[model samples]
Target: MSVDPEIFAKVKEALIDALGVDDDEVTEEATMVGDLGAESIDFLDIVFKLEKSFDITIPREELFPDDILTNADYIADGKLTADGLAQLKERMQFVDLTKFEADPQVQNFGNLLTVRDLCSYVATKKA
Candidate 1:
């Protein structure tokens, strides 16, 4: 699912407006936390901006699920269960969980999400 250039631009604009980042920094491969320096709270602002700009409602849980560590259905003891991984993969299609699949750590999962992921999600919502 290739993102339309126009939608990509809109997503970038929303990110820039919400996170106050330079245009060059908000590339498709840039992770919101690692590359673009987005804090946890910044996600709420970004989602709000995207919803208004695109005129689409994005369910918060679909984009950022509750902490898996605390969710019993997603974890067991200290490891991610198969059902949990499947659910995560479904919700986070934009993320490359190949490496994480081998050792699914709760803390690193959120960082795996990239700017392209958010853009793709918004594109889907608009469609």
Candidate 2:
């Protein structure tokens, strides 16, 4: 689905205001943690800011559910099982899972979440 540029701008501005990231750093493909330097703890603040800025509620689990790495249904022997990977890919469709699909590492799935993913999620909520 095509996202509205206005929505993208609002989402980007919210992320910048919340995360203190430079305009150059908040690209569509920028990984939240890897490229934007977002820590795990920063997600809560980010979500809050986005919600407040957009006047919409973002479901926590929909964005970044916890315990996937520890859940047996999602991980096996330090890696994501085939079923687990499928589930993750379905849940995080906004993310580019090419690398993770090639390697199938549960540990790295979280790393696939990018700034564009956040924008897409928010845009969907608004829709």
Candidate 3:
């Protein structure tokens, strides 16, 4: 899916400002955690910036979905069960989970959200 350039610019700006990353580093495919060096704390600032910039209320569950990750029934041996993956997929429609599906380790979930996914989310909110 092609992200709206305006949305992408705002998202890129938010990310750059929140994560203190160089402009060149915030590519569409860059993972928030892995590529942009965004820690969990940075998400708060990023979300706040996005909400302010776009005038949209962002529910925490829509982005984080921490409940699913912590649920005992959905996890086994540090990996997400089939049902858990399904739930995650349903919740995170903006995210591309194809690669994550191959290795559904719970730890890897944090690195799954990319810049493009974030832009898509903002576009949905604006719509």
Runs with alpha carbons beyond 4 Å of true place in candidate 2 = 1-3
| Predicted structure 3: clash tally | 0
Per-residue accuracy of model 3 over 32-127 as CA lDDT, tens digit each = 999988888999899999999999999988999899999999999999999999999999888889999999999999998999999998888888
- For candidate 1, the lDDT comes to 0.83
Ranking by TM-score: 3, 1, 2
The runs of at least 3 residues in candidate 1 whose Cα sits more than 4 Å from the true structure, single-residue gaps closed, are 67-69
Error in Å for residue 101 of model 3: 0.8
lDDT of all the models against the reference?
A: 0.83, 0.78, 0.93
Candidate No. with top lDDT: 3
TM-score between candidate 3 and the true structure:
0.97
Q: What TM-score number comes out for model 1?
A: 0.89
User: Model 1 has how many clashing residue pairs?
Assistant: 0
lDDT of 1 by residue, 1-127 (tens): 5667888899999999999999898888888888888887999999899999999998888788775545888887676788888888887776677988998877776677788888888777877
Worst 10 residues of 2 by lDDT: 61-70
C-alpha positional error of residue 29 in candidate 1 after TM-score superposition, expressed in Å: 0.3
Clashing pairs in 2: none
TM-score of every model versus the real structure: 0.89, 0.86, 0.97
- The per-prediction CA RMSD against the true structure, in angstroms, equals 1.8, 1.8, 0.7
Clashing pairs in 1: none
